[model samples]
Target: MRIGFGIDFHQLVEGRDLWIGGVKIPHHKGSLGHSDADVLLHAICDALLGALALGDIGMHFPNTDPAYKGIDSKILLQRTYELIKARNYRVVNVDSSICLEAPKIKKYSDQMRSIIAGILEITGQEVSVKATTTETMGFVGREEGLVAYATVLLEPVKVI
Candidate 1:
């Protein structure tokens, strides 16, 4: 078994759509980035990539490339899946957490899990998502941004 971890953060800015865990939640502001800027998905993608010792998301999907301009993060996730599979690694499970200050995410947790699990080709139960606030302490507490963390377990193609 192999383990990998990843974390991502995005600043909230006006005139953007709020997308979390593949679900669009009603909010006044959204994360700012070259892509849809789904922080949760970004973290998950990094985790998967890291598990294989390949690299992080930015290495494979650079923000400077127009090909990924305003791209859907799900597509990036799919491509990451292909890369890991090419190396004969299979995702066993994933766990993640989101830290934000507004617009609670409890209701969308299940949907996020389902979407991520489906993309990773694992059971929904194999993916878990949790949410929390920063208690108004720092950037997240001040509603300036949101961050997410993800960890994944993977198994090689064949056992010893």
Candidate 2:
């Protein structure tokens, strides 16, 4: 099995929609970026790419490109998974964490897990999504931005 880790951060600003794990949560501030800026999904994409030593998300989908402007992060995740499949590898499991100061996500966790699992074509049990606060400490605690971390395990696809 191959293990890969990834982390992403995005500043929170007014006017943008808050999206995490493909779920749009009600919040006063949203992550700012070229795309929807779903931190969780971005981290997962990086982890999957890292597992295959294929570089990070920016390399594949550059923010400088207008094609990716205001794009949905879920589509990015799907394309990343396709890369994994092309290499004859399959995701074994994925564990991820989201750190933020406001708009508690406990109620949305299950939906997030389900969405991510569906994208990876894995069971919900195989995908873990956790959320936490920094206890009023840093950028996240100050509510300036949110961060997400993801680790993924992959194995070679078995041939019949």
Candidate 3:
């Protein structure tokens, strides 16, 4: 068994769709980035990469590259999955947390879980997502941006 931890944050911007964990959410502002800027997905991607001793999301998908502009993050997640599989690893489970003040995430937590789980081909019970507030203390508390942290477990496949 292997364990990896990852974290990501993104600034909020107007005139963009709010996306998290591959699901669009109703919100006034969305994360700004070359990709969909799904902070949660990015964090999970990093955790998966870290688990396999691979470089990182930026190494695989550079923001400086135009091809990734406005790209959906699920593609990145899929690519990450492939990278792990190439190393003969399979996901055991993942636990993640989102930090934001505005937009209570409780309502959409289940939806986010379902979407991410489907992409990972894992049961919802294996992927845990939790949200919390910083108590009006930082960028997330001020609603300027959102942050996510993820920890994942991966198991090495037995070679036939």
Which candidate should be chosen as best, given lDDT against the real structure?
A: 2
For each candidate, the alpha-carbon lDDT, in order, equals 0.92, 0.97, 0.90
Scanning candidate 2 in windows of ten residues, the lowest lDDT window is 1-10
| Clash pairs detected, candidate 3 | none
Candidate 2 wrong stretches, greater than 4 Å: none
Q: On residues 28-114, what C-alpha lDDT tens digit does candidate 2 reach at each position?
A: 999999999999999999999999999999999999999999999999999999999999999999999999999999999999999
For candidate 3, the 10 contiguous residues with the lowest summed lDDT are 112-121
| Candidate 1 regions with alpha-carbon error over 4 angstroms | none
What's model 2's TM-score?
0.99
RMSD, each candidate, Å?
Answer: 1.4, 0.5, 1.0
| TM-score of every prediction relative to native | 0.97, 0.99, 0.96
Model 3 residue-pair collision total: 0
Q: Who is ahead in lDDT, 1 or 2?
A: 2
Which regions of candidate 3 fall more than 4 Å away from where they truly are?
none
- Scored by TM-score, the top model is 2
lDDT of 3 by residue, 1-160 (tens): 8898889999988898888888888999999999999999999999999987787889999999999999999999988988888888888898999998878888888988888888787899998999999999988878899999999999988999
What is the Å distance of residue 45 in model 3 from its true position? 0.4
Between candidates 2 and 3, the lDDT winner: 2
